[model samples]
Target chain A: MELICPAGTPAALRSAIEAGADAVYCGFNDETNARNFPGLNFSRDELRKGIAFAHDRGARILVAINTFPRASATALWQRAVDDAVEAGADALIVADIGLMDYVARRHPNQRLHVSVQAAAANPDVIAFYVETFRARRVVLPRVLSVVEIAEIIRETTCETEVFVFGGLCVMAEGRCSLSSYATGKSPNMQGVCSPASHVAYEETAQGTTSRLGGFTINRFAPQEAAGYPTLCKGRFSTALGDGYIFEDPVSLDATTLLRGLQSAGVAALKIEGRQRGRAYIESVVRHFRRALDTLEDGSEADIVSLKPFTEGQASTLGAYRKTWR
Target chain B: MSHSSVASRPLPTIPPLLTLAIRPLPLLPLQLVLGGFLQRILRRNPGLLDRLGEHRYARFGIKPVDLPFAFIVEAAPPRLLVVRELPQGLDARVSTSLANLLALVEGRVDGDALMFSRQLGIEGNMEAVLALRNAIDDAGLDLPGELASLFGPLGEPARRSFELARDRLTGPPEEER
Candidate 1:
């Protein structure tokens, strides 16, 4: 199986490749991609250079143009598709159906992989994307069990990819609006969820409270590990109790399930975090590469502990386990 | 020390005698030297502060727990002040070892990983801290190289000395060891 990694910058792209990434995915330094954070992503020239660097090393580059375009500003998204293709991206990971249609029609021979933002969970939807857009692969959302993933793979003709490590989004991909409700920016539209510009941390008498757009997301006592102010992973006071209402602060780690995913015929294993630094990219990619290599050698991979890179210093298998529900 | 006290106390990585030796040093001279260095860096990389955006206004307290003094950096109307005690009302404070701080500046160590390992402690505005981290990472500052460039004829020697001192003081990164 392929080990796809993330690159927020040219340096990170180099680090991922050096650490044994079979393919590296990145986006333009704009809203064209999901990780459109300030000081992250690539300029057009950087993307072109990064693709050349990867290609020279026999690794592929996948460009993400996954955000939905505004009706009035469809040209911007269309331009991104054209530029990504012009930059010689191995594949275009797209989410918006309209954008996918544009890519299919405009660049008929270019490889297309449906982004997880599309939330293409089941076989029928995956098949539709394969037939309509001629999408060669579909990144399955983080809301599937190993059994469910196998079922989808069994029925769908397109290749399948699963997120093996990094941030875990509890809400359905491409459909979450909680961030927009609080910050007026959604990942699907603005390519940023709980954007740092709108996030604030305050040291109060109670402890440290993380607030997003004037609303408290989570609070930590002295010395407790703090998490990023993601809306879905925020703590809340429901009628029953004052604690994590939606999901706890944890990162996705499916290292143990590599064998299961491979058995289920996963085409690629993805490491999420294009917003992360090169150190993170290097370490995580190296660790996963070792794990995948060990698995190929027909032995259980002795996965290194990745707690330090995880959110809240905790890792969960996420929805990959049936017991997660 | 208790777990609660970890944030305030110096990490055990530093020799206690080294911290004791640093305690007697006057702050004013260090402050002036660091202030000049900050200006030189800003002049060299003008776009560095721009990456912080509105966060440039925030006061960032950089506490190298192993060191005797801390630095409060203000990106807007730029200032870098060394103080024996961290003043109240700073927008954010990040506590870690001096080695980690230098490594972070060079993008050698990941901030999230440091935080996850409980080696880095951050208080107050996370957004501002994140902005500062991103800005610094994007700038890709090389302190040794910057210091070396300051001296035209003795550039190589200055860089060599600085790197030697850094290696002697901090040793190799934990991963390398």
Candidate 2:
């Protein structure tokens, strides 16, 4: 019943709230949250200010302390929960069970939302977080079809949130460790995947070759537009040829599927691009808000305008339609 | 902490561009201010680090062993380069000033864009140079703040110098996080 927006920074948060987000989700600058790039994220004080700003506007703030705990840095993760509670975050979006246990016992008043990183697709796991950790909501992984979603809703008591637009994760959100296998960094441990420090590019006599930790992901000819070399979208040399092997490089555009999501008992829709700028936030949130309003008014929402923002200017229904694959 | 310390305390100069990034800047104190500024900004929006590809660390990845060991970025001149130790290393006399390097770093000058446009004189182990680009992705450049802090008052400028050059040498900043 709510439109959840992503806010990577204070400015982005303001943009989302002003643009009409019902709720906003963000994380601290450290390894506790995903999207852990340098020169980004709020300190504890900034989180307090951001929460205050959102509350003043009648919007909710969701703190994402979603990365799994590293054995050595468990204390930092525990402290992140304490700080978010001090800042008055409306909910704690968590993936690690250990962190969940820490919060449930130490700060019982805090609301806990299961992060998509937890990859809880079945009612059993959602029920696990809800029964054990008392999770109020679960952000479903992007791997299920709408029918599977309705089935999940029928069985679980927790609220549901689906990603409607922006980048799509090829692997299960919370469980992925592909980048770590190639480089030593794990999104779970370090809160970053395909970390910038491990990316390499070359403009040989050939067009351009993009590498992640020395592995060639994609090679753009002199003519093909060069996109950033993320691992999932990289061209791999399988027995199959040199092209995007795991998944194609495309943004998930679900404007046409909102009707199905709402009908399938989804309580909310989320847009995933916290690292985006204010302009990007404003544009995407506004578009989706209007789309949802139109749908509520008994009309089909138009989504043709969402093309430019898509990955490589291409969009796909992505696991939403049972037949997409 | 000026380039004066950098001059006599030689780490073996490969090229003026690869080492002392001196031109015009407020100096070490400025580095602290810059870090504070970044820390302040990051404190509010924590997601700003990974947008597009602007992050400093993505340049250091692990696989495909054929990658460069280091990069020498000069922001004022707008230059990004692959640098590796040569077998017969040159003891080229260092002549450039730090003030010039800082100005180049801040976009007060345009040295980097010039190199990209001209495809100028940058030499190294090209095969190995490929890896440095993905070092951030490789996690090689996971610079510890404490390691950065070891420079003491000189830390900020040193880090700033590394960041500015890295930003320039790397591709344009990624779209917002």
Candidate 3:
């Protein structure tokens, strides 16, 4: 299987390729991509250079223009598509139907991969994208089990990619509004979920409290490891008790299920973290590369050594296992 | 030679006796030297501080737990000074060992991984700390190379000494492995 890694900057793109990524995915430095964080993403010139660097090493570059664009501001997204194609991006990962239609009509020869932001979980929805826009691949959402993924692959003609590592979104990808409700800025539109500008951490006598948009999201004792202040992973109070109401703060590590996923006909294994630093990109990509190499050699990969990189020092298989439900 | 093996290599730690030996020395000279080093870094990477955005005004306390002193950095206008005690009203403080701090600054170690392992302690404004991390990571600062560039005529010798010290103190260079 192809090992797809994330590159937030030109340095990270080089690091990912050097560490053995078959293909690296990145986005432009604006809301045109999903991970629009400060000091991240690539400029047009940087993307071109990064693509040249990756291609020289026999690696592909996939540009993401995944965020939903406003009807009045289609030009920005359109320009991103045109620029990415011109930059020799191996493929474009797009989510918005309008943008996909534009890419199909404007640059029909360019390969398209349906972004996870589309939440095309079922085979029918996957088929619609593949048949209409000729999407060559579909990034399966984090909501399906290995069996479900196999079934979907069995029914669809498009290649399938599944996230094997990184952050877990509890809500459906394209439908999440929790961040928008907490903060006025919509993650779907603004490409920021619980934006850092609206987040505050206060240390009191009781504990360290993390608040988002003036609303308390979680509190950690002095000895506890703190997590990022996202609404989905927040602790809350209910009449029954007070605890994590939506989801626990943990990263997804589906490394143990590599054989299962391979049997399920997964064409790519993606490691997600475009906002991460080069160290993370290098380490994670190197580990996954070794594992995939071992698997290809007909041996069981020993995949455990990633604990120190997980959020709150904890990881879960997430929806890849039915027990998570 | 794989990157994973290099990343998993054990990190070096400063000897306790060295830190204790420097405890009684005056801090003024050290402070001035650090201030000059900070200026050099800023001059080389002009966009480093600008990437912090609004957090540029915040005061950041960087404490090397093994050392007797800490550094207080005021990002706006870019001032860095060594302090015996962290002052009040600082926006954020990050505490870790000197070796870990060096590794982090050089991007040899992952900050998130360090934090997850409880080796790094952070207090106060998390957002500001995150912004600072992202800014530093984006700059891709090579501390040893930058330090060597500080010397005029003796740059090659200084770089060789720095590399030797790093290899002996830590492990071999990742590329060499």
Model 2 segments more than 4 A misplaced: A223-228, A299-304, B1-177
Residue-wise C-alpha lDDT for candidate 2, range A178-294, written one tens digit per residue: 898878899776788777567665557776676778788887665454344578888777786666777776778888888888999999999987754444566678789988999
Error of model 1, residue A129, in angstroms: 0.7
Candidate 3 per-residue C-alpha lDDT over B4-104 given as tens digits, one digit per residue, 9 for 90 to 100: 22334446667899888999999999888778778899889876776677788889999998889999998677799888888888898998887677767
Task: Order the candidate numbers by lDDT, best to worst.
Answer: 3, 1, 2
Q: TM-score of every model?
A: 0.89, 0.67, 0.91
Better of 2 and 3 by TM-score: 3
- The C-alpha stretches of model 3 lying farther than 4 A from their native spots are A204-207, A300-304, B1-20, B47-59, B74-76, B89-92, B121-128, B153-157, B160-177
Q: lDDT by residue for model 3 over A1-325, one digit each (tens)? A: 9999998877778889999999999999789999887767888998999999999999999999999998899999999999999999999999999999999999999999999999999999999998999999999999999999999999999999999999889999977999899888777877888887687766677777888888999988866765668988899998979988888888999888988999999999999998777788888898899898998898767654777678887889999886764
User: What lDDT is obtained when candidate 3 is compared to the true structure?
Assistant: 0.85
Question: Which lDDT value does model 2 have at A215?
Answer: 88
**CAPRI class of candidate 1:** acceptable
Question: How is the predicted docking of candidate 2 categorized under the CAPRI scheme?
Answer: incorrect
Q: Model 2's DockQ? A: 0.03
- State the iRMSD of every prediction, in order shown: 7.4, 14.6, 3.5
Worst lDDT run of 10 residues, candidate 3 chain B, spans B1-10
Clashing pairs in 3: none
